[model samples]
Target: MSSPSTPAGDLAFVVRTIARTAVDNEGAFGDLDAVAGDGDFGYSLARGFEIVLADWDTLDPGTPDEFLKKVALVISKRVGGTSGPLWGTAFLRAAGAVKDRTELDAADAVAMLRAAAEGIKARGKSDLGDKTLLDALIPMTDALEQRLAEGGPGAGPAELAALAASTARTSADATTSMQARRGRQSYTGERSIGSPDPGAVAVAVMAERVAAEWDVRD
Candidate 1:
């Protein structure tokens, strides 16, 4: 089957893969989030994505930015906690990157990711190695940029998605061994060693889901 690039394709993948992510992460995100903040993160996220997928068609956000803004607003209203705002911001920024696109190319995807990373950093003021979503965002953006540069902007979404997944996973997994120096988890100090940050987990889940949905598995 041809891979997804248009709004319809993005819609289909998002609906199915988001549910898969919630199933995969289960309580892990909630449990860790409870340590320093409200415990509703995973639940809120799952609920929000469920809602987003269900009304995804009706959303008809017009442009990518509008689509993301709609999701951000919907998620913020329907779900409670920092997760709603954080995820909303990420989507909003990515959406902004492709406001003019009906279908995102490899370069367009890279722009989306770079915008996403910048949004997270701007909102959180955290840098790479802080063990936040930037952990995944930085690597993922770099991977996309490298792939696009080497293979040209015409590189397929599946291949780009594959590289993005690999990079995100690497960043997410590496956090398990490192100490979190950012966000609420920073207070945990060495205690945060064994558990991955919920935000990082969320990033990994989103990237992996998008990769699979787009038929990009490495």
Candidate 2:
């Protein structure tokens, strides 16, 4: 395969990719949210992406950081509930990680993902095993980091992203057995065990998108 293009084009592709993912999974996300939240997770994300699509032409194409900052602003302002701020913060953190970079390599992608995961952790004040999005994100980032650390000469962004995506799916599935420790779902005590966290599902979706869309070449 070929290497991915510069950050500016990558941003545009990622936006479109996420928008499609949101629309495709909105119903399932709502169903998952209905298990613990107000069932608005899907609608909120779809709406936020809709706004992004509408404003696609205006997004800055100069750098990945600027584009992600714009994305964060839109998600925070247009989406409602905790998801808005949480996701926005993640994107913002990613933007900061890549600030001033015109292109992103495999290691940069790993760093950005790691930054986003840490952002979610700090912003949500949540931890692993919290039965939140962190469950999926943390594990995925860990897997990516491990790949980057171990695969020395051959590891590429697409391969690492695929590994992370697989880990995300597994982590998200594991959430079904974990009782919620934070968020409104915590009120359910043991009753929330049957359903996975919607946010976790969304994180898995993001991982999948990155794995599919990112170009990986040495």
Candidate 3:
């Protein structure tokens, strides 16, 4: 089960890699929403990532599930917004999806992403058309599953990660035309237009970092 394919190492590596990338881009996301949003998203995410890493080395979780659960605690505590709980739930659910896996394959990767989408939807009570992270996540999940079902074309974690990143990027970019139907921007209605949602942008960051860190290709 567990082997080079699984790539076992410190949980901190996962947290730090994703957090650092998200931290760098979080501020830009806030910049896009400075006019309407509280503009704290960038700092809040960075803080959460920073805090999540503090205990990374101590957690020798046997599976992605355990690691995600720990990250959920930190994400909820570190970030003080709707995003905190939403993302925390997504991560926790994803963790649960792979709890028993000693090694993760392309299919396993897709399962994690699908679980993440369902988690966010269940927790946030948001749907696909309503234009939240779900907008980005659902399509990305679909793409990954589709790719995998096609016999995967010499796929591995690296290829799967790349596909996820591409899917996330396209979804985030597509959000420009979407109206905010949930979260902090929901209250704004049409005012939410033009500016992309912070959560959607963060999804791209999260996907990219996950791919880069987990990519097994030399």
Model 3: lDDT to the true structure? 0.74
Cα TM-score of candidate 2: 0.90
The residue pairs found clashing in candidate 1 are none
Report the number of clashing residue pairs per model.
Answer: 0, 0, 1
Q: Lowest-scoring 10 consecutive residues by lDDT in candidate 3?
A: 1-10
Q: Score candidate 1 by lDDT.
A: 0.71
Structural similarity to truth (TM-score) of each candidate: 0.83, 0.90, 0.87
What's the best-to-worst order under TM-score? 2, 3, 1
RMSD of candidate 3 to the truth, in angstroms, is 3.0
Cα lDDT tens digits for candidate 3, 1-218: 12333344433354567777767776686786564567877777777877766766665545666777888888988887777888788778888888877665657667877998898898899988776778878988998888778873556556767788888888888887888887777788888788667777778777787777674422
User: Which is the leading candidate under TM-score?
Assistant: 2
Segments of candidate 3 deviating more than 4 angstroms: 1-15, 210-218
Instruction: Evaluate model 2: give its lDDT.
Output: 0.81
Pairs of residues at least 3 apart in sequence or in different chains that clash in candidate 3: 65-95
lDDT of each: 0.71, 0.81, 0.74
Q: 105 in model 2: Cα distance from truth in Å? A: 1.2
